[model samples]
Target: MNPKWWKESIVYQIYPISFMDSNGDGKGDLRGIISKLDYLQELGVDVIWVCPIYKSPNHDNGYDISDYCDIMKEFGTMDDFDRLLQNMHARGMKLMMDLVLNHTSHEHPWFVESRASKDNPKRDFYIWRKGKNGGPPNNWESYFSGSVWELDPQTDEYYLHLYSKYQPDLNWDNPAVIDKLHEMVHWWLKKGVDGFRFDAIAHIVKKEGYPDAHNPSGATTVRAYDMFSNLENVHTLLQNLYDKVLFHYDIMTVGETSGLGPEQALDYVGDGRRELNMTFQFEHMNLDAASPGSGRWDVVPWKLTDLKQIISNWQTVLHGRGWNANYLCNHDQPRSVSRFGNDLYYRIPSAKMLATFIHMLEGTPYIYQGEEIGMTNIALESIDDYRDVETLNYYEEKRQQGVPEEEIMSAIHRKSRDNARTPMQWEDAHEGGFTTGTPWLRVNSNYAEINAANAVKDPDSIYHYYKKLIELRKKHKVIVYGEYGLLLPDHPEIYAYIRTLEDQRLLVILNFFDKEPVFELPADMKQGGMQLLLSNYQAPKNDDLTQLKLRPYEARIYLQQLEGK
Candidate 1:
């Protein structure tokens, strides 16, 4: 297999709205990101993926882009964006923008024209269907919890919106739409941006016939995924996209596939498939889902086995076919330390443990902004403070359904997207050193002790741990390009794997539980002098390899010095 740069690159994700606020305008802007380039460089990141900074109505934050060509005024002007790109490039970093082709804000010129009159040339740009029984076009429920179909009185037709009503899903079946998308891709690539993180990309194609879904067990709203997930045309459309645009660019592309796995995902990102460089699968991230197939916004207890299996499956399956984008937290999810580690009690140690668990795997590692600071989830006591559209909608619906405010609050505490959208903690200040005045969103209450300034200076901070983890990945190409083979697959409590390249073998052993566990060496790893390369608990010593033992959350990486290499 040919060596892929992304396969060994450590990508950092920046939530532009929360990364930093350069102007005292209380919102993070492009200049803020520019000023922080050195900081990011010091963190050892090669590629940076910024969330949408495109013009929008803030309905779904910046995801509901109104103009793909213009920058959001709140973020900065096009000049600021240009300066940011130059600065990032000068520092040897590549920039990847969020490409949201799934939907667009209704205020967009194309959408406005489409909605102006049914006979407009742009009307076919969006999906507009007539009502079947004097109601919505279909029973599909939006991802944000209402009817996915929105009535457009102007055209007397219902438009599809997998997300918010203000955002209409584009009709990908149209060739015109594909042409425009290709133009947009080239526009950014020509402007010097490296690539894109395709947003909700799996929702590109809908199930034909638009069948009614099987009603959710406990919820009143129907899940549209049941009707549209992994639809037949999805692969066909993706192949067309690859042949038309993505294949022509020398840039990285990762799809935000909400419902795909190694099997179904191979066609999209399989080796040399010309579809995408990689795809972000949410299988591991959704381990703590309150219900198996339900979209309940509550976090249930998750075991280490759940995480281990999710990672093992992707790593094993993607060893040769496709590639996995390894991550713990993103803009839509809570902090890793809070979700996977014991943040309150074992903050530093657990953060390091979690970092070692993911970074030392066989894929590209994406470090979310503030993740290096050992950031934890926000504990919002009142629902009024939540700013996400989905959270607000859920709160209102839960209220009307007589589900007590307390129950709703509990769910929000566990699953609200706002929990991860808080401002980045720069230092211990009035606004957690994120902004001068009131921030666009509230800062986490614990930011006083968990800020970038503090973490970067502390020797034992999670930031340093992340630095070491990334340095290891960049230094050892095998960690990224090697084949992954899980060891002790049935060892109830331990998560262990070996990544091997030609003549070079590395072993990662992790004790996920609090109790100490012994990991017997596999037959292949028994005969060699092993040197400890890295460890989350303690750096391994040359003599400590006679059958490995790991303490609670202890993760270690060993270099097997083969005798015949």
Candidate 2:
């Protein structure tokens, strides 16, 4: 395997709006991010993948870009961004900006002109189609909760929007649009930006024609992802992007490819593919959904076996064929500790255990903002406390469907994106020290117990555990490049795997639930000469590896030496 900076580095994802607030505006800005450089450096992360800071109308937060060339005023001036980049580079950390090219805000000049008149030069820049039967062009559903098509009054045509109607989909088939996007990418690269995390990249290329989905009744807002995800032309477009611009810069790129399996992912991130360094696959993220056809709001109890299978499949398939971007939570998902671990009684142990699982995996581990401190989900009493468009839209849609108010609220509590968008818990002070003014979103009510200040002060806190995990990854090449092998594959509550690189082997045992499960070594495995590499709990006095009982959310990593090597 070849060595690359991105492959060996740890990425920290920051939702800038919720990260910090330097001014009293209640919104986190570039200057606010600049203020936290020391704290990020202390976390031992090599790259900071910030969510969109582009100029936007804030319909879908910053994902709906109005101006590609300018920074959002709420985020701060371009000068502040330049300083942010400089400071990150000074601290030996790279900055990866979120690139939302699949769509642009309806307020964008191109979209504005496109919607103005039929003969507008920029009309073809966006996907505009005539209505089929006094309704939207087709029965496609918006990701947020509505028809994908929105009728424009002036043009008397419907424009495609996979997300919110405020975010109009761009026409990737148009050469002019492609040229404009490429130019903008180069503009950022020339400004010394390190890399980009492509948002909704898989949805860039749609089906050959605007085909209607199989849904006869388009009342429900359920998306047929196959209609516009991971199309063949996407690879061609990405290859062109690589040849024209990305080839000139030594930078990293990861696509938000939600619908790709391991084999399909190779088309984008495989070695020498000239498309991307890696891509974020959503297979693991969707395991907790109630059913295959169910929406995200229909949450269910996820099993440890299923998680192991999904993760193992990705790891084993992408071992050397492509690369993986390992993560459990991000800006669009709920907190990992709250969703995947026990955030009530076993918050610290489970958080540490989750960190161990991610870092020990064979990929570049991405740590979301509050993840290092074991931040959990917020259960606001009313739906009014939520600020995420997705959550709000779901609430309204369910209410109209006659779903019980309590059930809707419960689902929101479990699956709302706002759970991850809360202000960073910097301290236990007002608004968790994120800002002196009111926060754009409510702070997690548990901030008093989960703030970063407390974590930093305590040696045994999740923050320190994360810092130690990162340090181990830096010291042990096996953690980054090793081949993964699943152990105890059928174990209900224990998730265990071994990473092997040459003579070095690392055995990772994790108790996924709050049960004391006995983990017995397999027959073929040797137990001699094993050294405890790291553990969330204290080192056990006994060296017997044949059988051991695990504590609730306990995680252990042991280094074993081959006989004579």
Candidate 3:
């Protein structure tokens, strides 16, 4: 394996607007983050990956950037950002900023200038094409619904926006656009930013021809992203990016990878490759997503075996070639404990169990903000509670299609991006101690009981447990470099894996559901030098090594042999 600081580092993601609110403006800002730098350092993370705090229209939250150089007014001035970076570096933690290069907010200067007239200097900076038969440029559907093309009456042309009309896709094929992107990146790198997490990196380069995507789902517009995502030119663009800017800086680059399978992932991220340090894979999360023969809106219940299979596949496939970013949840996904574990019944142990499921894997683990506190998904009373554009758009589209409100809400509750965007639960006080005033989004009602203040006070809390887990990664090279092998691939309720490196062996077993699962030691693991390294239970009793019983949502990490031998 190629040795790198990123490989041994633990990354923590902070969704800025929800991380902490320094002022009473109801939104989390850079000052708020600065206030919590020590808390994050104490959490033992080596890097802090803050989601876009760039100037945005908030159409898609901070993902839709309006300016590359400026900070959003709500997030404070550039000076505040400078302080945050300084605080992180002083704490021995690196800072990674979000780089949304593939698209920009409609209000961005480039888009504004491009939309002015067809012959404008920046006209080709964005993807703009004349309407075909008075409709959109193509039949491609926007991720937020409707057609991907939005018509500009002044120019009488349609601009491509894969996400939302407020966010126009940049024309990566244009030379000037590529030059501008390089300048922006170099500008940030020179500003002392450690690295960047390129957003929608896979969708940057579209196929050469503006082809109409087939309506695979028989929807009003084409929803298949094949015509635009993971295209042949994306690799070229990334490599070019690496050469133009990334090569100069000693920085980490993790792409927000999508629309690609496990094998295709290697071309973007591998040892000695110039493209990226790592990329987030969706196959593990997509196991609960729409599968073959399922409807477009279908959300399936993931089988534990399938989740283990996909993760193990990545681990084995990318073992020595590329690095994987192990995560069970993120800013865009629902709470891991709520989705994969029994959140309502066994929230604490299940949260710890879920953390073990990913944290101990043979990859760099990312702990999403608030995930360490066992935060459950928000149970909103109505649609008005959600602020995510995608969630609201999907709801309106479904409602107009005669879908029942309750059914739509059920899906929204299960998959809404806002679930993870809820303000951090700092204390048991009102607004979850996130803000002095009302929060931008509703805090999870359970925060009164699941706040960080309470967790910090409890020695065995999930917060302390995660701290230990991260510290373990710092101490155990075996966890980072050891080869991974699934122990119970076929087990439906237990996630068992063993990591081996020369003379060291580590066993990780997590009971996913809220029912006790009998975890008998496998025949191959009968050798008895196992010392329990960590357990979620208050008191772990291991009378018989061969025949072991695990409580509901129990998680245990065992050191296979004693220290020296």
In candidate 1, which residue pairs get closer than 3 Å at backbone N, Cα or C atoms, i.e. clash? none
User: Global lDDT of each model?
Assistant: 0.83, 0.91, 0.87
TM-score of 2: 0.98
TM-score of each: 0.96, 0.98, 0.97
Per-residue lDDT of candidate 2, residues 1-565 (tens digit): 7889999999999999999999989999999999998999998999999999999999999999999989999999999999999999999999998999999999999998998899999999999999986888777778887889898888788899999999999999999999999999999999998899999999999988878778756454447789999999999999999999999999989999987789899999988899999999988888888887577899778888989989999999999888999999998999999999999999999999999999999999999999999999889999988889999999998999899999999999999999899999999999999999999998887888889999999998999999999999999999999999999888899999999988889999999989998888887777457788889987664456787888899999988876656
Q: Which residue pairs show backbone clashes in model 3? A: none
Q: Candidates sorted by TM-score, descending order?
A: 2, 3, 1
Worst 10 residues of 1 by lDDT: 537-546
Q: Which regions of candidate 2 are displaced past 4 Å?
A: 216-222
Q: Pick by lDDT: which candidate is best?
A: 2
Cα-based lDDT at residue 124, candidate 1? 94
Candidate 1 segments exceeding 4 Å error? 215-221, 538-549
Model 2, residue 519: distance off in Å is 1.1
Alpha carbon lDDT at 250, candidate 2: 92
On lDDT, who's better, 1 or 3?
3
